[model samples]
Target: MKIAITADIHLKQSKDEAPERYNALINIIKKIKDEKIDKLIIAGDLFDKEAKNYNIFDEFVKINNDITFYVIPGNHDVGLNQKYFTANNLQIFNSAQVLSFNNNAIKIFLIPYSADNSMGEVLAQNEQQLPEKWVLLGHGDYITGQSTPNPYEPGIYMLLTRHDIETYNPVKVILGHIHKREIFGKVHYVGSPCGLDITETGKRYFTIVDTNSGEVTSNKILTDILYYNENLIMLPVEDEFGYIEQQIQKMIKGWSLSDDELTKVRLRLKINGYTSDLKKLQSIVNDALKNFTFYNDKEPDLTEVNVLKDNERIQIIELVKEAIEKNDKELGLLQLTQNDVMEQSLHIILNKA
Candidate 1:
């Protein structure tokens, strides 16, 4: 049995809100159909928020009418009020009840996000007799050494630890909720199938799990999406401006940036070496501003500037004055107020300038 597992679609009808995310999901479904995938499993977070917009849900039904989909409720899906209901052939599992797919060859188990009342009781009772070659599908945090703090749930937390996998021992445990892709033991987080926000920038993809000969083989399918890669480059004064321009160009080259589209670029430059002409850097900055539509230009405060040579103290002070003249207050303060050595030096420079 070949199964395509994805999560965090966050589908909404409004184009202004999550149009890219919705389009990405549509593209993925079309790809799945072309490949003739047998089963489709969505771990959770199918909707951004639990609001009744049947029109959006109806559009989802049209796209995925052919395939059999099994989904669980995510934190966002449940929200403050538990609004769980049925839609078409899509089964939304919100409790710990074991849903058995009684087909002869493949037996699938649908496990959704559990309430406090159900999780402990269900795990305690049925921890022993899990079906063979079955898949455990749900959305929750995994209790691993790499688990980080999440603000989605205030006090209550859910985790499928390594110990839990060893105990139940399903063929494959596919899950969601964690936005980044991760593989621990036999359990796999398909991550968000589409990029939801800037924090979700990376190679977003889905997993195809093949269950044949009682063993599961997983492959990743990359999606068509836009993601940002943030970089902080430090260079000599002569190379600083050129380096910044090059970085910006690299981000925009061969990439499609739509009008009124926003892409975040965080650039920090620490100039160390001497340059005969400081004004040359301005040309590079101007070029970047003219070429890029949306970006944030952040040059280091004076404290962050590194004086490479001990004898080049006078040169450093000159650079600090130039930075102040340019209204780079953060850099100016760092240079003047950081240490007695640079403070006294910059104090005299400021007085003289």
Candidate 2:
């Protein structure tokens, strides 16, 4: 009987409320107390809109009051009210929640966040029938016209269709207001564990329902901050500084990031074409991207690099000496200085005149 799903952790009410989003929920409650798991579901925005700190989320539910933190109310905390948060271990689900674990041998179903009923009209005010392998949590927008939008609420609040998961036949339909990770077959969304921006990139999760083999997994949550965006294009030939040092070593080996994981990377580099040497291509892209720290915070945008002047460097050096004399007479090779070595590599280009 395991349970530890999460959601859009917007969490902010200003008071320096973002220590990497409460330190990624305090490392998912210290890996749910080192997998001694007690229960921690939070299928909603958990606060970000008018975030009233709630005593900094009750100082993280008083550290660990034996881990029991169920919360609901997405669309950025819509109609929230659990006595405005005091956290006697934090419960806060306004309505539609029928939970029972290990004792009655697990029986789940919850639905909060209702800016005017839609989640099957609030589970049809609980007719209490679905319990045979049932399991469905909630937040909003489950397909049919809106394929995962809600980056921070822009329309539609609570609407989970698929005929309400085929008329509440729930086998596994946990959800949260789309921050990224998504699935549709059995419905799942457990996204935003970190990287709340830069389009929420790689690795971050918290989902693990298995209330007696209904099965659902995913636990990874080592987020301190990660985001990358790379783009390097420069080939006005003549080995443009060995093609910008071999495309910055293939963009730092496609970010296989080592060297101490490069300080939790937040890169966003972009170096466009044509650089016969713009200050040695900005010193080989600032010494191989100087271990990124610029997610648009500056540099690495050489105004679309364009150095070759003088009539476009004599028409691209006579179109690369007519494609190297048509590949030197179809590879027979010959005594060719190759147009004085393409006019000595466009005379070591550096003419801003």
Candidate 3:
């Protein structure tokens, strides 16, 4: 049996910002249809919020109408005092339920978000006779120390750890919620399909699991088309403003951005120098955005700016020193004194200014 697993497809109605991510998702669905996968499991976070965006579900349903789609409610899908509708082909497991598809030679034990029940207990209670091969589907933290409640926990912290999976040892544990893709034992968090925010940088992908002869083989599929570029410029103490602008222009020339693409571009620039002049740096970044997308008649859009003040650097150094001192005391090294001793024993953080 072939199963395609994906999660955290945060589909938003706003198109001007995330066109690439949306397009990438549509392409991935096409790939899934082409592969003729038996089951498509969206572990969690299908919607960004349970707002009035029912059309998002419509678009999602239209894409995967042919395949058997199994969904589990994520923290984002549950609202405080609201009701949201799920799609037709979508089987939402809001509670502890074991759904078996014997005709297709597939069996799925659905364990949804439960605040009052322990994960181990739920698995023990729902334990039923299994087929030749089965897949366990849910969304939660699969690591011990990394289990954190979702932002919208609704007064209940329902999290699972590695121990829960060990007790209910299924052929494959397809999970979600932790955005970083990782594999531990038989459990796998396929991670987010596309980069949702700036925090989700680098490569993002999903997984395809092939269950044959009671064995499961998983393959990762990369689907991220957007690239985030961050540049930190430490200006010379006495450098001219034009010099910084020229440096930014040089950097922009080396990238794949064009003026038309500048409006859609997401870039962050950090400028650190002796002078308090920041307008020049901002203007330079804006100009670079304009120049790249100039042919397309799009304005350069700068996402963020981090300007460092003279005292801010010193404050950071002091904070680091205090943190180190606290850590040393916690480690049973209370006798250590003197800044030099601390700097020697521990690493001293220097302020650039």
Candidate 4:
């Protein structure tokens, strides 16, 4: 039997975000249908919170009636009622249980997260009774190699150790709770199906496990909503104003923005030298970007400029130059005539000329 597994869908309805979260999940389900997968397992966190919109979820289940879905409640889905999902093909595991499928071909030791009980106690009682050929699906903070308290869990729930699973020796272990896809020995944390935050900046996937051969694989999907990338560039101390502009242009051009995709880009520049027209430089950088919510952080390095053995008037000129060369690195400011502290100092020395 071929089973498709994903976790942390985090479905929520929001006015600011145009229901893309639901759409992204529908796209994944469509792909699964196209692949003719037999079963779909949502390891945990099917909703960002207790899902209040039952009608929308019912609609989602009705449209995908061909596939059976096994869902486990995550930490956020604590106290989520099975009545919210009214599909005959749906199986909700609100607590620890065993599920058998394919004429005894596969057995799943499913442990859903509970705010009331300790997961460690649940595992200890049930793991020893696990069948020889079975998969362990759970939601908790799992530590491998060595066991310790996960700083994030505090006292909300108890953690499961990888060593604990090894004793039971399940064929495969699939887990959720962590938002980044990771593999520890025989266990897998299948991450979120879509990016939940700006830091979740890479491609996402759903794992496919073949029950016969006990082999695991993944299907890569392109995310069309909410993308982010961050980069840092350095500017030399001797670069001229025009050279600085050219360098900034080069960096911006290097980023490939899709015409149809909305992406967020962050650029940080650590500048070493000086330039006179700082305000103008910011404007040029702002106008050069497209299809990006641009943000930049630029810092001027005065350590090198301060070491120059020049007169106070000449030093002021150098400082203004530094500001101009460091230009256009911050987002949102477009004024081309506003003078900074160093620029005002330059003006004072030049008698407002």
Candidate 5:
């Protein structure tokens, strides 16, 4: 049997970002329903803060009653037991629990977020009873070389160490709280199902675990907002136009958008470096891009970008700048313009020669 898993949704009501994340959730659920996956497991952080918008979640759950959402309390919502969050097809695991499937073939250990205890502490009793093939589901920090505390809120919450993984030895360890998708051997941080914040860039995915084959895979979930913030670096080459257009085209292709999804992309393009003609560079972007919303609903400004005159002259200028940069990289010795710095650098080189 195949099970779909996701976590760190951070669903909140009465917020500016409520719709963006909420719509993504709807799309994810719809995809699950369409795939005929009856069981959907949410590792944790289904709600953000103490925003007890139970009715909002309840309505969505009722509408999609066919799929059972097995949820565990995350650090943010550890007070879940105190809330009146009632919904059909939603089993919120508030304690250390286990769910058996496929006639005792697979056991999924659900360890909810706890402030006082570690994951190994909670699963100590089940250490001996761990089935040959089992999967662990939890919500918190896993202490490892790569594992870092939640950047948004830096603190230890029910930490999991390598010892925990070695002792329990679940077939797969899926977790939430870390917004970046990370993999350290069998431990997988499922990450945020969708980008909850603008800084949380990249396409998101929900993991799939096939109990029969003991294989874990991820299926990418591309949602409403496809945000691309890029620095379009310019070159001083004669054929730089092709290079500039190529970068823009490559970004468009990376989006993997169909005709319908063309309107979903939001681009924040910042042109830097020296171009043959600044206006020409801006024109190139205009000609290439069809219909993408510029960052702040304002067109990309290229007026400040440097204009290239002569390639040979630039190379000489660069060589001198490089030599001067070795001594004063930040130009901290004095406040000097481009000409002043280059003139001073030339004078020093002449004196040395």
Candidate 6:
């Protein structure tokens, strides 16, 4: 049987709703039905925050009715008592249980999420010999060290380790918590189907597992409502503003964003040269980059630096220029621009006569 596996669906309903997320999810369901997949498995995080929307169930009813869906409640969807799901063909597993299918050919060891340290107890209590081709599906922070709650946030979560999995020894373990797709041994972290935030860069995908052969494949899906590209350009102290502009353009020339895509390019120009009017340089770059439609533009890190101070300005510039020409020499000119020396120079040049 062919089964589609995806995680971190993060569905929600709001006044200013995100249609792209819903559309991406709907498209996946369509693809599964079109391909004639037998079952759909969502590891966790089907809802964005809380499972408040009854409309999502109604929406699922409109989709394929034949395909069986197995959903494990993630941290976001774990607020209420969703022990049993009676919508469409949805099956909710809120606790640890062994789910059998295809005349016992496929066994799914479902470990639902728990905020407390009760997961260990559940595993220990339900310890039994799994089938030959059993898969472990759960939602928790699987980490050797500490758990990062989200990609951008810093918070420790209830953690599990590879050693914990080896103790159980399933053929494959599919987890849902980390937003980045990663595979460690037999455990697979199926990341979010869509880029939830700008911090989540690169393409997003879902997994298609062939239960017959044990072959897992990734299917890339486009779910980005906005495209964000952040680049840090290093330059050898150039006095010409146009040179910086040219370099910025050259660096971002590889972007193939559609005209309708909301694109944000944050150019952090770190230069170790002398230039007039830092504001004007920023204005020039901003105006030059105005062709791209970004939702929000941040103040560029315009580092027009002077390695020398006071009377030694010209001498230091010359020295910096010579060092840059060497190319072979690691002068660390870019490093100097990021430190307090550049800030001091900015104060001296911009604030003084």
Name the candidate, 2 or 5, with the larger TM-score value. Answer: 5
Q: Please, what are the lDDT tens digits per residue for candidate 4 over residues 1-353?
A: 78888888788754235365576677778888888985888888888774667567667777788988889988878766678777887888877787777755667788888765555678778766767798888887776644333333354344677667767777888877776677877878787777675555455778888777767787765465544443322222244345556665665555454444435343333333334444544454444443345323333222322122235655556566566647744412655432244344445555664
Candidate 3 clashing pairs?
258-292, 258-293, 259-292, 259-293, 259-294, 260-293
Tens-digit lDDT string for candidate 6 (1-353): 77888888777764247566676677677788788886888887877775576565554643667878788877777753443334557777767788776764667787777777544555677776456667777887777553334753355444567777777777777888788787777777788887676665555678887666666777866564544555443223444466567756764564554443324332333444445455666677677776654434544455544333344554454454444446533436555433234334444543542
Model 5, residue 9: distance off in Å is: 1.3
What would the TM-score be for candidate 3 when compared with the true structure?
0.60
Q: What number of backbone clashes does candidate 3 have, counting pairs of residues 3 or more apart or in separate chains?
A: 6
Give the alpha carbon lDDT tens digit for every residue of 1-353 in model 5: 88888988888865455576777777778787788888998888888986766778877887888888888888888877524556668888878877887764667888988888889898896677667778998988888867754567587778889998887778889988888788888888887866765556567788888888768887777577666666665555456788678767877787677865667656777775567677788888888875777655767667546765766755665676556557573566566543356554544433432
What TM-score, computed on C-alpha atoms, does each candidate reach? 0.67, 0.33, 0.60, 0.69, 0.79, 0.73
By lDDT, who's the top model here?
Answer: 5
Kindly report which residue stretches of model 6 are placed more than 4 angstroms away from their true locations once superposed. Answer: 79-86, 103-106, 118-120, 146-154, 226-231, 234-236, 239-280, 297-353
- Model 2 C-alpha lDDT per residue in residues 130-220, reported as the tens digit of each score: 5666688988888676475755567776888898778767788888888777777888898888876666766678888888887888787
Model 4 residue runs over 4 Å out of place are 13-18, 145-158, 229-231, 237-288, 294-353
lDDT of each: 0.57, 0.74, 0.57, 0.64, 0.75, 0.63
If the candidates were sorted by their TM-score against the true structure, best first, what order would they fall in?
5, 6, 4, 1, 3, 2
Deviation (Å) of 284 in candidate 5: 2.5
Q: Measured by TM-score, how close is model 5 to the native structure?
A: 0.79
Q: Which ten residues in a row have the lowest lDDT in candidate 3?
A: 344-353
Best by TM-score: 5
At residue 284, candidate 4 shows an lDDT of 45
Per-residue accuracy of model 3 over 1-353 as CA lDDT, tens digit each: 66777877766656445566566566666777787774677777766763456566555665667876777766665431213444566666777666654455546676665545655667777776544457777766665654444443334335566777666667777777766677776777777777665545445566776655334444434453433444433332244356556657665655544444344444444443333455666666566555332212433333333343555544554455456556765545556543334334222333322
lDDT of 5 at 183: 88
